[model samples]
Target: MNPLIQGLATIILGVGGCIGYFYASNLLLDKVLYPAKGPNIASNIRRANIIRPWLFIFPALLVLTVYLAYPVVGSAYRSLFNRSGDEFIALGNYVALLESPEFRRSFLNNALWAIFVPVMSVTAGLIAAQLSDTLKWGNIAKSLIFMPMAISFVGASLIWKFVYAVDSDIGLINAVLAGLFGAGPIDVIQIPFWNNFFLMFILVWIQTGFAMVILSAALRGIPEETIEAAILDGANPFQIFFRIKMPQIFSTIVVVWTTITVASLKIFDIVYAMTGGNFGTEILPSYMMSFMFRDDGRATSVALVIMIIVLPVMISNIRQAQKELR
Candidate 1:
């Protein structure tokens, strides 16, 4: 009954059971239920072809329903109930959330993040992608620029936290500023409103790499002849990029924008690790966590709000993907 052993055993059993069930079920369907050697061999083969894809897809559909669909519904339901879940409060939680100053601040900060992070990240990424391509050691430059994408949000926050640390000696930014200006250390995170941008800079740094890699690929995929024609027509580098190249890569830019928009809405770790959602840096996810145990209905309401905010971006991304597929 050791917890570690029990967990390992459960994992093994779960994986083994799924493999066994799928293999056995497929075997049963082919061998016992519809033997290909029998008189109706052609019919059996056709039926198997029709059912095989569904067999593979069914497990994924079930997992999506269980993991994704369930939680959304559960959150919605919880938001309608009281803290103890014994009493129904209807739209009271949402009304309270909209009315709460803290929630309003979180909402505004989140909105600012959604706007600032994506735009700045995409802009920085596009510039890096375009510039790196023209370099002789472009691949090396791209690799260096893309490096931060490998770091987790919390890890990046820790790294930037040192840069923003109150101590002038240890923190890189304050130390340099102090040395230059002969001033004391600055507690950047304690500064209201502006501190949110400081946290946003971390995300922009991390996501710029993502945007760069994607946009870089999109940039490279552009036809060389088009750029050659642009140059032949007396187009400068800026003209070639803005007028000729950018139009082609616009879709990818939108993709990167919406993708990062969704991410900024769900940002938690950086703010949590850096400021613990204090000093005007609180966002929706962090606010939800703060209220989770103290007030279940309000916590769920905040979660639902976050979901609502991200849902449209998700839908747009999905639609764009499908359009591209078509």
Candidate 2:
């Protein structure tokens, strides 16, 4: 039961089981089912050649079915039931979610997150990318900007919590305000309507660095000859970037945008850490947590809703990436 021994045992069992399964399955296929040495050897071998790839993939398929696929299907199924899950109440949880004021508020907040975070993060990142590329010490500047991405979302939120603290001496924002204008200490997160944005800033601050890193690479990959030609044609700096480079790397931008959008849609950590979904900052994931244990149906229904919203963006991202490859 020792933690280290348990981990080692898990590793050994996992690896050993995989090896044993593959070996045993192959043996069964070759010796029993296919029997490549038998009277129907040629046909059996051909059949096995066709089936061999699936054999290799079967374990992976099983894992996916057990983990990802089952959970999705099960959540959808369970969402049909009532709070206790003892009675069948088809579409009941979804209806209740639609009726609930908190659910509506959470949905709106999630929408705000999905829209605001990706747009601001990607735009800021693109600008940072361009500026960093233009500046002499751009790499150093990028490193400083990107430092936030290295911090976990919870950590970043806690850091920002101090900045937004109510105490003038303890909080940086209040300290500066007290210095310049002698403004009173403010509990920023307690502010209604706007507090959602205040919470969102933590995520944006964390994700902006990720966007910058991605967009910087994309910018660098733009052909230099195109920029040179644009300059020869009397295009300004802004025109050269928007007209020339933007078109070239739009796919990468979409990839980054969708990636961030999906993260924002399912974001829980920053809200959970800082606000705990209080003060109108309740996103879907955090909203779902409010119903945890007490109302399994509604919690899962919220999860399903998050998935429904995110699935399309994910699919679009995939298709756009595929188009870029083509």
Per-residue C-alpha lDDT of model 2 across residues 1-326, encoded as one tens digit per residue: 89999999999999999999899988988989999886899999999889889989998999999999999999999999989999999998999889999999999988899889998999999999999998999999999999997898888989999999989978898899999998887889999998888888888898999999999999999989999999999999999888999999998898899899989987789999998888888889999998989999988999999999988986876786799799
Report lDDT (Cα) of residue 13, candidate 1. 96
The local distance difference test score of each candidate is: 0.91, 0.91
Query: What are the models' TM-scores?
Result: 0.94, 0.92
How many residue pairs collide in each prediction? 0, 0
Q: Model 1 — which ten-residue stretch has the worst lDDT?
A: 312-321
At residue 207, what lDDT does model 1 achieve?
A: 93
What number of backbone clashes does candidate 1 have, counting pairs of residues 3 or more apart or in separate chains? 0
RMSD of each: 1.9, 2.2
The residue pairs found clashing in candidate 2 are: none
Candidate 1, superposed: residue stretches over 4 Å from native: 1-14, 324-326
lDDT computed for candidate 1: 0.91
lDDT of 1 by residue, 1-326 (tens): 99999999999999998898789878987998777877899999888878878777888899999999998999999999988888998999999998899999999999999999999999999999988888899889888878899999999999998899889878998998889997887888988789999999999999998999999999999999999999999999899989999999998898889889989998789988998988988899899989978999989899999998888877877887799899
Candidate 2 TM-score to native: 0.92
